[model samples]
Target: MAENTKIEWCDHTFNPWMGCTKVSPGCAHCYAETRMDKRLHKVRWGKGQPRQRTGVANWKLPLKWDGEAQKATGAFDESFFNQAKLSQKRPRVFCASLADWLDHEVPTQWRVDLLNLIEQTHNLDWLLLSKRPESWSARLHEAMGGGSELARRWLNGEPPANIWVGTTVENQLLADERIPALLRIPANVRFLSCEPLLGPVNLSAIPTGEGHGLNEAFPRITMNPLRRALRDAPHVHWVITGGESGPNARPMHQDWARSLRDQCAAASVPFLFKQWGEWRPADDRDSDRPHWVGIPDGSEEDFSDSPMVRVGKKAAGRLLDAVEHNEFPQP
Candidate 1:
């Protein structure tokens, strides 16, 4: 992972570790897993070992920083807090795009190092996304050990102000299981990522209230399903919506994407439409070929240098509409 990435929704990507096991349907066609298996074979072999392609130990490389802000001092420094260029400024850094920072397989010490990086980079907003938000929450509490100053700081509302905790909600089942766990983590910003979206999810249908049995004297806090159910849950401020891409990319209906966009608009949340995946729309349900041929509009005209493609062909990354500018959280 690096400071520069073409992913439209974020300013940069940072992965302190590499490799992960699939935890949900969203991992069906993970681009990162494929890249790790095919391209960086040797890095998967062991720790501190040099891969065939790169002579140096891959772990020793400096965390990719886009600007010439100089190296970070100690584990936590102001340099790490510097912002990216305005043209490239999306503010939110996609933490662990290639690996799960909170994966159980990762050493606890490594997680501390990653958290240190997050704390150090205070100026740039950090977006921590995971399919295993529960594991992350558990590990975090364990690391802080019940209630230390560090734990108190996080629990007492000093959880790296730049960090936003989120979880992936691909289908209703996963949404039901994971969203609640995501809400339990204490972070400055809380939101959700429903991209590579596999099925429709209705957040309104979720149950809201205190879990089964607790002291009745607890004020009967009518636990706002959207807030209490989601730890310190605030109104969702940002949403990224996109369909799958690649040969086996699933078809996403225009209505589904539009519905979420509309919901976000109604709630005053910023919405970003990333792309239409490989399978295009066919007039008849049985038609083998896409009916509205040519790439989706708003997608880059040149496919030669684009990283995203559809069904082994260059996708213009267009939307149902004939426009090309789908970037969101607009300035």
Candidate 2:
């Protein structure tokens, strides 16, 4: 778990599980996959313990925090949980950056454990983002099915107050499939992560039908036709935007991010711009020489004279034309 993440959208990151199998086009540059492959190779050499193909290992366990003691003991305590609690001045924490908390491969007991941990650490808000919100929707349905007492106790009205649930919307297909599923979760604070922006996603396409099987489980958003359609669909309080990173990183054009920033502003939702990623527009690309060098690579042409499309997060990363570090919405 990274107590402080350089990824500006998330205040911190916690990984209950560290490995994942790719499930979509967005998974092509998955950071988790890269790390897992490295660890697996090491394990094979006996440098590290072997991992169960299906179960989460000790290293994959979610970091647990003890807030009650931390409140009483002050910040200097050496206890792990206390240290994490003291370190966070921000409101929300991103849970499981390397793995999906709702991944079917992770046992239900582990989910319960994670939820319980979230419940206990009430002071620190939790953001649970998943590419597989449908899996969580199914589990929530099952819990509600048997009229189980435990389920009733835990998931009666909506998700825990301290936890915000969100789903990744990489492209249109995934946005259609996963966002609706996310709308069904009982969490009070629901949001969207359109990070590693892959394509131009029009949020208006989200379904807003009534009596959709999962509608009652999660309330819909109401306002404009697009917002109203999504109203009662699932309430998205915040939006985090970013471009891809790492070698072979995809270039996210400036227009794509600006469109989202504009939409979020119109909707009155908080917008966060995370990074520029690896590539930028030809004009914005850093040059070794001064402008007086006059396009050293070739002609005496001005690079800035080209069409104004900025690539990479740094050039396009500005949110509402300014850097905005938003506080987490109330849980």
Candidate 3:
């Protein structure tokens, strides 16, 4: 129950349950797994392990937040433009930071209960970020009640006004695999969490078309199957990129973050640089530098020309080339 979160991007964080099997490379050093399983022993992390749901009072936290949001909404001016402004003013809830809401192993009833809670919290924007975007449609449809109109809208890629869906893309392969699946189901604001970025990712890679490649020419006679197959694709509304944190965290290439930020700027998509994580460029100015953690000699040697120094998360900070990117997509 992180009612007041320090996640940089969200107002609060709510995890319905605790426990998750590692699905991708990004989960290698999960802070949640470290804190919950190894330290707190709240729930074991792996397949076949049962997810432990939070207490009844924990479940009611969002209801309280929603009521507060409703009160704020009531104070806004009633003009049509102000309605949009009010939506933007709504507090964001980053749901299931400790577990995947669409995790196949979680009980179906748990997901249904979460959905019911979301329905009641229309005043708050629920960001349902998942590593498993492929399962989102089926899971959401079932949770919404299969034959209902709400279910139909979700299946049709138009989810509720307050729900924003997103997926994690650590590199090009995942960006290719997950971004397309995410774009297929348009949400109020679709986003990509490129946190713990493993390698350089070209967000505008032709076939993936994260938020670019719209002007590419199509074959007039349909001889080129690939070109003809391409259709106008939906754009990613926001991009959140950052390096890794925690023990054994991998250092992200500075260019990897820069590439994403440049791509987002070109596409007019909002971009948020969360943090530099546990590593920072060795050449950073003395004014911004923190107490340097001593690393073994030659440990800094890497394939890249520019080396990174382990500075701890607090010292590493969230500045990207000295600029703080705190942009968020319009609701």
Best candidate per lDDT, number? Answer: 3
Model 3 residue 198 CA deviation in Å: 0.9
Q: List pairs with backbone clashes in candidate 3.
A: none
User: Which lDDT tens digits does candidate 1 get at residues 138-253?
Assistant: 67765566333344477555666566777887766766777666655666456667767666666655433245257655543332233332344543445677777765565555
Candidate 2 whole-model C-alpha lDDT, 0 to 1: 0.58
Tens-digit per-residue lDDT, 134-248, candidate 3: 8877776676663345556677766677788889988777777787777667665678899888777776453543334455464222111112223444557788999888888
Predicted structure 3, TM vs. truth: 0.84
Q: What's model 1's lDDT at 53?
A: 28
Q: What does candidate 2's lDDT look like per residue over 183-219, in tens digits?
A: 6676656778886677666676566344566656765
**Candidate 2 deviant stretches above 4 angstroms:** 39-90, 141-151, 213-233, 284-331
What lDDT does each candidate get?
0.56, 0.58, 0.76
Give TM-scores for every candidate, taking all chains together and pairing residue i with residue i. Answer: 0.71, 0.70, 0.84
**Candidate 3, residue 215: how far the Cα is off, in Å:** 24
Question: Which whole-number lDDT from 0 to 100 does residue 261 have in model 1?
Answer: 71
Assess the local accuracy of residue 312 in candidate 2 as a C-alpha lDDT between 0 and 100. Answer: 38
Q: Which window of ten consecutive residues has the lowest lDDT sum in model 3?
A: 220-229
